[model samples]
Target: MRRLTAAVAASLLPGLMVIAIAGLPVPAGAAEPYDAYADEACDGYFDPLLLERGSRCSGSRERSCPTVRHWTPRRVSRQLPACEGVAQAAHPLHAERIQSSYLALRPDHGAPRAIYLMLHWHRATAHEAVNYLHLQDLARSRGALVIVPDVPGNQWAQSGSRNINQHVAWVDAVLADAQRRYGTGNLPVYLVGLSNGAAMAMHYACARADRIDAVMPVALPMYRSDLAACSFSQSIGYVQVHGDSDRFVPYRGNLWFASAEQVYARMRRNMDCVDAGAKAARLESPLTPVDIRYGDGCVGGRRGYLLRVENAGHTWPDMETLSGRDRNPYGLIARNFDATLQGYDLLQLAAGR
Candidate 1:
């Protein structure tokens, strides 16, 4: 497993610069992906061209030329089985279904203190479960139960009003079932999501604050629709992880030309914590320069932490191995970055808050 340093992470920014150069014109009638309240023409804040090129681009220059036709949702859905297979292999402890599954791991000693509700990226189910397991193992070591449920249709962000409400209902069912089985008061519940799933987690936090004590959204897009109804106060402790070189979610900013920092700033404003102070810290990583910015500039006493990986793409920070050829850069990055450590940090923040 190759580790990325800050210098390495910084080097990846040029790729984004190139994507920005090849920018696409915003579609006139594009429906916002998440919130239905937004204007239909407001095609998210992130650049679809950059995301498509960066995420799907591959091979040598001649071999990597853009396809003549655009991708359709149906086409993407056809690729879901591969991702689901990966998830199943990664977390054998978890029970699988057509749309979702559950992974259970018990601690070596005492009862768990918290239960993590892990969400997968678009078109990716248990295939990405290994990454979730890495965190689950750490949680188990610390006496925490990890619950990962697969969202049917591989939908994370509310694609529409119906999907949003359906997701909310599913979440409610899961929580209710968990409570009935394990006595809700015994363990704190936390939510974590990656990529579009991150956006979904934000939506969940906003709509179901009582169910989540904290949330960590990684490599997320900055879509106005996603944040349209989001009230920051509901997100008691928010930890966002992003890579500066992420082509899917560029560090330079979104199609709206807003940087991730700016997006968080907007979120802080919405949460009524606009005056919170931000402090910077470094994270342990084998690859890329990882820095964490935290403090109370956004929501009064409440705090937010942003993990920025320099020169990194759309991947997790510290994983041991790359799962597939098409794995998100940030997910690959997670091999080196410890989600367990992140989970613990969330626990601490939740305790303090």
Candidate 2:
């Protein structure tokens, strides 16, 4: 008789009451089922301040009022779990400071064959150098590891800026890091730079010629006074390109910069090139006229090239069309010859690839 009476009472009440009487699992912190349903249901009661609900109940699930939830903070125990075993000392993070910041790119499909250390011009970032030269293309084609490092203050150490030894150390550190991490054992190092960066490359290459394989300096603005400081130990593959109409770093010479011809002559003299074995040619292209002068039969069988672009000025040839914030406002860019392509070609030529 008591069980029948209880069943009849349960049938008259809500389903939640039935669940509570049956002792089924319910969500913790849940309110009384009757009150919760009244709060969550889309009934006729509406508040003007509440923009979410309609004036009247729509009887649609989409228009239904949201259920209110109360969250309580979980308590944390001071004791560690027994399964954690003995506590060990936490290892602290240690950071080593480097001199310069750099951007590096490696080929996706193959092991890198060589390391190309590309230096950027004064007041420019590594990103600009990579974009302006389309260096990724070189990485893809030659399977070369390209690294563009920004000099401190975005300017390479020069006559009066900072200590040149520190800059040299930075370059050494970059090479060491690359070799250590990538296992670039016995791989050739190619130094490529432009303008102020070009001068830096020349300085470092001269200082460490035995380790470097080749160097290509474009629009080099070498100081005449600094010539006495650079003592070339051994000649490597040397290539330079300068615009005849470059006003910034004048083609002939300037008050502060040495003439391109003079610099080329100095390189040849240091390399001990035999003039009789030198070759000269003029190539006419739709973009610009190129005068190529190559000297061979130097000490250690070294080679040097000087490419003079006619009517071009103070710019990396064929970079105007590239997408970047850099603008050649100082001089005109020659579309005829691409310096980036020539750089890779010359590197390959030196490597006998």
- On TM-score, the leading prediction is 2
> Model 1 — TM-score against the truth?
0.63
The estimated TM-scores of all candidates read 0.63, 0.68
What is model 1's C-alpha RMSD? 15.9
How do the residues 257-353 of candidate 1 rate in per-residue lDDT, one tens digit apiece? Answer: 2467876665556545555355665533334546666666433355666667766667554332322221333322433244444444543463334
| Ten-residue stretch with the least lDDT total in model 2 | 71-80
lDDT of 2 at 281: 60
lDDT of 1 at 5: 31
Model 2 C-alpha lDDT per residue in residues 1-353, reported as the tens digit of each score: 54333222211211111011111233356444312122323222211112133222111122111111121111100111111111111111111334455666676665887888898776666655664456665565556787777666777776544577678777877777766766885788888887778878988887888778788888887777766456677767778888898766778986667888889888777676778766766544333466777757777666777889887666676552222222244445554345665455665454333
lDDT of each: 0.50, 0.59
The parts of candidate 1 lying over 4 Å away from their true place are 1-101, 131-133, 157-161, 232-235, 256-258, 274-277, 284-287, 297-301, 322-336, 350-353
Please give the clash total of every predicted structure, in order: 45, 1
